[model samples]
Target: MGAAYEGLSEKTRTRRFLASVLHLTETMLDHLVDDVDGVDHVALALVGVGDDRVGVPTAIAR
Candidate 1:
């Protein structure tokens, strides 16, 4: 997830958060991955399948 976030273009990141999000704080990461009940909030990731990029999200849906 961190790797994926780091890969986001500045324009994409800004569009996502409605601001310039340079990096994820631990709390933000926890919230993104852990908080928000699935009943109301959901996130889906499309990740790279293998090699050094394994598990890195290529795209995401929320």
Candidate 2:
């Protein structure tokens, strides 16, 4: 998840998170990942294979 967020372009991050920064502090990330009730809002990542394996966040939805 952190890797995916770091991989995002600044413009993409800003658009998705409504912030000017490309990265969030660990504390902020933890807060975002916390679940409420039985539900959790999340960003789904698609990971590649082998030595090139990397995560890319594809969607964020409730």
Candidate 3:
């Protein structure tokens, strides 16, 4: 998820996070991960196939 967030375009990041720069600080990531309810709310989609997969999330809702 962190990788996916980092891969977002500047425009998309700004729109989604309402910030010119989206910084996923360790503290922020920790908070997100610690939120059990938030875990349930998140959704992600990755590209590529199987064990060789490598990609960013195409969509997210949280």
Q: How far is 46's C-alpha from truth in model 2 (Å)?
A: 16
Q: Candidate 2 regions off by >4 Å?
A: 38-59
Q: What's the residue-level lDDT of 30 in candidate 1?
A: 93
**Poorly placed runs, candidate 1 (over 4 Å):** 38-62
Clashing pairs in 2: none
Residue 53 local lDDT, model 1 = 52
In candidate 1, list every pair of residues with a backbone clash.
Answer: none
User: On a 0 to 1 TM-score scale, where does candidate 1 land against the true structure?
Assistant: 0.58
lDDT of 2 by residue, 1-62 (tens): 88898898888888877878766788877777865344445454454455656555555554
Candidate 3 lDDT tens digits, 1-62: 78888899999889976778677888878766654454555545455445766564465445
Top lDDT prediction, candidate number: 1
Error of 3 at 57 (Å): 12
Using TM-score as the measure, the top candidate is: 1
Candidate 2 displacement at residue 30 in angstroms: 1.0
Q: How accurate is candidate 1 locally (lDDT)?
A: 0.85
What are the runs in model 3 whose C-alpha is more than 4 Å off? 37-62
Whole-model lDDT per candidate = 0.85, 0.69, 0.69
Consecutive 10-residue window with the lowest summed lDDT within model 1? 48-57
